[model samples]
Target: MLAIDETAAARAMIQISRVAKTYRTTDGEIPSLRPIDLSIADGEFVVVVGPSGCGKTTLLRMIAGLMPPSEGEIRVGDRIVTSPHSDVGIVFQSALLLPWRTVLANVMMPVEVKGLPREIYQPRAEALLKMAGLGGFETKHPWQLSGGMQQRVAICRALVHDPKILLMDEPFGALDAMTRERMNAELQRIQRETKKTALLITHSIPEAVFLADRIVVLSERPGAIAAIYTVDLPRPRQLDVLGMPEFVRLTTTIRAHFNAQLD
Candidate 1:
C-alpha cells in the first residue's frame, strides 16, 4: 500500500509547480493562469473554486495533460505529465456521452479505444455501472436518461478504466438544485468507495466545502492560488452536515475569500 503522510501529503498525487499558461490571440498574447504551485495528495479530494473567468478549467486541463503549461512542470506520481495518459480520467460540465451508445457501451468506450480486450474489462464496466446506480439502465441510451442520470453515467465512464486520478470540471453545475444536491451526496459515496485522487473545479462555495478535503480558491483572470483551506471535516460526510454550524462556518469562510477577490 502507498503510505502517505495525511498531515503533509498535500504534496500532491499530482503536482503543479510554478506553472503558467499563455495563448497567442489575434490581438496579442493572453495569459490565463499565472505561476501556480499546488499539490493534490493520493486519495485526496481537492476542489478549485473561483469566479467565471478565473481560469479554473485551464488549470484542470493542464493537470490532465490535455494542454501544456506555458511554463513550469506538472508531475503525476513520479512521472511528469506532458500528454494525456490512461492513468488519468476527466469529466467536464457536460456528460458528453455518445448519443447512439448504450450506457454500458459508453462506459466501456475507453477500453475499446485503448484496444484492450472486452473480456478483460467487461466485468469491471458492469460493476462500475452498478456502483453508479445504473445497473438496470445499462442497455439504455444517453437520451433515455435524466440529466442527473446522464452525469452519473459520465462519472462511471471516467472511472471505468480504474484511473488513479479523476479530474472533474463542474460536473453537476447543470443540474437543478435538488438533483445537484443528490449528485453531491452520490459523489461523496463514490469517492469514499473508490478512493481515487480527485481535482474538482467549481464556482459553488458550498459544493466545494461539502465535497473537498481541501479547497483551493483562485483569484480572477490570470488566476493564481489565493488560498488553500483544508476541510478537516469527518469523512463519509452526511448531507445533513451541510446544515451544521461547522459546515456553515467553513462555507462562509470560503465565500469570504471569493468576496475579497471581487473587491
Candidate 2:
C-alpha cells in the first residue's frame, strides 16, 4: 500500500481543464472530444461510459500522457502531463502479456522498463499478484490462465509499480459475460483495497455502476460530458448490490442518455 501524503490528499489527484482531442490527416481533420473539464479526487474510482467512438479511450489516453490533447491541459497532482507520466499505470482490453514470460515476470515489466532495481520490486510484484488472487500462479504462463485470470494478471501488473492513478480502457471487455461480472467484483475489491485514484472506460452500464464512485457519461462523436452520476452506494459493494433499487435507478437514468441520443 502507498503511504498517503497528507497534503497531497487534500487536492484533486487529476484535473482536466477543457481538454479535447482531434486527429489530423492529409485527408481531413477529425474531432474526437470536445473541450471538457473533470476533476478526480485522491482515491476516487471514476468510470467513463459512452457510445462507441465517443472518445472515452481518447480521454483516458490523454490523461495517461500517452498522447497529447489538442486543447487544454491535464494535471496529475501538481505536474502537467506533456509526456508519459511515471505516476500513472495503464491497462487495456487485452492482457497483452508476453507469450514466454512467466506471470510474475510480466507483472514486473514496468519496473524493469523504468530501470528500477528488480531486487526491490520483485517482492512488491509478488505481493501484488497475491493480492489479485494469482499468488500461486506466478510461475504459470499467460496462455495457461483463463481470460478473467489474465486480466487479473494485467491489473496486478498495472499496480506493481504502485502508481498513484490507474487508467483502464475496457479492461474486461473481452471476457465472457459470467467472467466479466466476476472480474467486476474482483476489480471493485482491488480498487477499494488500494485506494488508487482510478478512471476506467467501459461500455457496460452495469459494470460502470458497480465499480464507480462517480460515473462520467459522454455524448456521441466529438464527445463531451453528458452527465455525471454519484453512485451513493455504501462501500465494499458486493454483487448483490446490483439488484438494489438505486442501482437499477441509476443504470436506467444513465441508459436514458444514450437512448435519447438515438431518438
Q: For this target, which candidate reaches the highest TM-score against the unseen true structure?
A: 2
- Kindly state the number of residue pairs that clash in model 1: 2
Residue 107 deviation, candidate 2, in Å? Answer: 0.3
Worst 10 residues of 2 by lDDT: 1-10
Q: Which candidate number would show the highest lDDT if scored against the true structure?
A: 2
Put down candidate 2 lDDT per residue, 159-196, tens digits, no spaces: 98899999999999999999998999999889888889
- Please give the lDDT score for candidate 1: 0.89
* CA lDDT of each prediction against the hidden true structure: 0.89, 0.93
User: Which residue pairs show backbone clashes in model 1?
Assistant: 12-40, 13-40
Q: How do the residues 114-204 of candidate 1 rate in per-residue lDDT, one tens digit apiece?
A: 8889997989999988998888998999999999999999999899888999889999999999999899989989988999999999888
Candidate 1 runs further than 4 Å off: 1-11
